[model samples]
Target: MRRNVRVAAYAVCVRDGRILLARWTGAGGPRRWTLPGGGMEHGEDPYGTVVREVEEETGYQVEPVALLGVESARRVIPRRGWRRSAVDHQAVRVMYEVRITGGELRSEVDGSTDLAAWHKLSSVGLLTRVPYVDTALRLWRDRPPTGRAMGSP
Candidate 1:
């Protein structure tokens, strides 16, 4: 198996009972809804990566308010697109709560995300979303004071 490691930052931006999300367009088949952030570039700080990703994916300026948690996971992805072999991908994800500061809302063209919009927090289930969205929302609402992540037994 081909092993790959990725480090990414994600934002949970909520306002007026709605949450901002970007439709992720990866080499995989279908698009999945996720927070407005993505992988950090070489030697890039996580904070700067989140800000840059949020702006690139969803034309909006944001300030990360608090660091929510970190998530590490491994998944198997089938060979597709340019990938000649299946990949065992390990991702270290940093979750953050962010506040929108400025800029207009617009979808990214010719990028990993083609659409960006707000979804009603109560109705997020209607959209196809990545697992991180669920985890981030749970973390945001639970606000575990100890700063420890919860896991299923």
Candidate 2:
């Protein structure tokens, strides 16, 4: 079995009763919303990854106030409809209840996100949000330990 692991960070930026989210355009043309963050660079700290990704994707600087949780997932990728490979992505995301330190919200033209906006937390389910949103929220609500148990498979 071929395996790959990836670490990423996401920010749960809440401000004025709203949460910051990014609309992502998927390869299948579907739009999905998610928190402002992304993958970690080699040897980069998870906290730094979120801060950097938030700025890059949302044009806003955020400071990580707390670590919400970590999550992982595994899937099989089919190559040309026959050959397949198992891929595992483990994200040690340090979700922070962030406040915008600076910069205006803008879409990253040359980045993973296409649009950035603030939405009421209550209305998040009404929009097309990535699965991670729910997971992150649950973790935030529960406030799991920094090195607590692993997420469900």
Candidate 3:
């Protein structure tokens, strides 16, 4: 198996009992709601990555107010065809608490996310979403000193 590691940044923007989210339309799979952020460019700072991604995905200018935590996970991606090897994929994700500074809400244009919207906190669990959404929210709510949720291994 080949090993692939990805580093990405995500924002947890909660306001008025709602959270800002973007609908991911990548990987040619089913769409899922996720935080408004993405992978960093070469030599780009994670701070810049989050700001740029938020704007691109949700048309919002955001200022990261605090470092929420990091979530690292490893998974195996089955090979798509006979010639390719199964991938050992690792994701090192950085989460941040951000506040919207400016810009009107709008969907991204021909990007990974097709729609951007704010959803009621209570309604989040009713919608289809990526697991990271819950993870990030937990980090935001707990704000553990170790940057991980309480009792999380």
Q: Report every candidate's CA lDDT.
A: 0.90, 0.78, 0.94
- Candidate 2 least-lDDT 10 residues: 85-94
Candidate 3 per-residue C-alpha lDDT over 1-153 given as tens digits, one digit per residue, 9 for 90 to 100? 899999999999999999999999979899999999999889999999999999999999999999999998899999887799999999888999999999999999999999999999999999899988999989998898888866455
* TM-scores of all predicted structures: 0.90, 0.85, 0.96
Ranking by TM-score: 3, 1, 2
Candidate 2 lDDT tens digits, 22-110:
98877666889998888889999988899999898888988888777677755654444456655554445556667678988888996
Q: Clashing residue pairs in candidate 2, if any? A: none
Every model: Cα RMSD to truth: 2.3, 2.5, 1.0
Question: Per model, how many backbone clashes are there?
Answer: 0, 0, 0
Winner by TM-score: 3
Q: Tell me how candidate 1 scores on lDDT.
A: 0.90
Candidate 3: lDDT of 69? Answer: 94
lDDT of 1 by residue, 37-75 (tens): 999999999999999999998999999999988878888
